[model samples]
Target: MTRYYRVLSSIIVFTMMGIGSFVLSKSFAEDEQNRKGQPIKSREQQESKASNNDLAKFMRGKLDASSQILDGLCTEDFRKIISGASKLQELSAAESWRVSTDVMYRQHSAELRGAVKDLLNAASKKNLDGAALAWTRTTLSCIECHKWVRATLISKG
Candidate 1:
């Protein structure tokens, strides 16, 4: 087990070195950008940028894998989306869904859950089309929720 321990120690050392290099490079880049009078993005702005970048990357990956412009999604994905919705609510961009008279938010939530079930079934049967359709449905749920939120959830202002 001496060899195993040595291998593990080497891996740990290498990982730390890699991380240190990344941090040093990033710091240098930021400093250079600062020297150029480039305004540094605030934490919130950076987060928003990263979120958009991640979504775009997800979309691109989906397209490359499916050979189509895929509306890649799933139930857990909707859960994350709704979590972001909650964040918006807390940020005063949206209020409670209770404001909507038509109950669109509830319907959207149900649709997402239903799509998840459908996707699970498709996966069990090894049906790619069904799974992709269901995935798209999850994104649809977010759209539905957003529509209602936009329609009814008013700004705190």
Candidate 2:
């Protein structure tokens, strides 16, 4: 009975360790993947001149539209949002009735890109209203991204 109890305890301990290691390995791989995909700011070297400890790097989506505007990269970039072919397909693959006309729609981002392209194509003959509306939409995306993921707002102001 003593020998049997010792073997059982050893088996349980090793099994728990195996499970813990598996979970740790999975988490480590996910962290590695996230780090790999995250964009390293090119201007960080120049930006480091501030040296403020309060500065937070991550930005969020879903901020109120009236909030402050972001400079450099779009706020969407902070949300890990990307416009890869897979996302494009995912957006368009759905039924028309299922997708709303709201600006929050994933398709709206692609549409915003298209509108900007069209705006540039007609720069010489620019329609002020169209340009302005497109600009608003683009900025709104930034605001939305900030609303959700911008909890780390750091300001020395």
Candidate 3:
């Protein structure tokens, strides 16, 4: 029963991640369309648009790393888990990951880093249960951070 519960939980977490990815992709497409509809009147605007595109590309990389982790979790592939977690950690340290200078954003980033570290540790130990738990924490951190980002953007707008 405990094993069954663990598997069920993992399935649920992966499903949620997939759905979130789909929604985020749709949102990005819509935002891109909206930006395209606007005329860029200045060099600054063009530079800003380029920066946004770069950030979007960086975010896609993060999503890809996350998907790799999910695939590893499902397949019980410790090497893949380690590889994905390492990529995530590296990405988190990159400048692109610092999207906001806000304290809360920093806190969220720290939480994510911690979760990824936990994931790496669990994977290294070949502890599937621990890794799954860490993955769940990682996912929650991402969701919380994204919510904060969206709220902050809306408020600024």
TM-score of 3: 0.73
The number of the candidate with the highest TM-score is 3
Task: Specify the poorest-scoring 10-residue window by lDDT in model 3.
Answer: 33-42
Candidate 1's residue-wise lDDT over 117-148, tens digit each?
A: 66656655656677677667755775777676
Q: On a 0 to 1 TM-score scale, where does candidate 2 land against the true structure?
A: 0.25
Give lDDT: candidate 1, residue 36: 96
Candidate 3 clashing pairs? Answer: none
Question: Per-residue lDDT of 2-27 in model 3, one digit per residue for the tens?
Answer: 99999999999999999999999999
Which 10-residue window in model 2 sums to the lowest lDDT? 57-66
Per-prediction backbone clash count: 0, 13, 0
TM-scores of the candidates are 0.36, 0.25, 0.73
Q: Candidate 1: which stretches are off by over 4 Å?
A: 1-102, 155-157
The Cα local distance difference test for each model comes to 0.57, 0.44, 0.94
Task: Find the number of clashing residue pairs for candidate 3.
Answer: 0
TM-score ranking, high to low:
3, 1, 2
Tell me the TM-score of model 1.
0.36
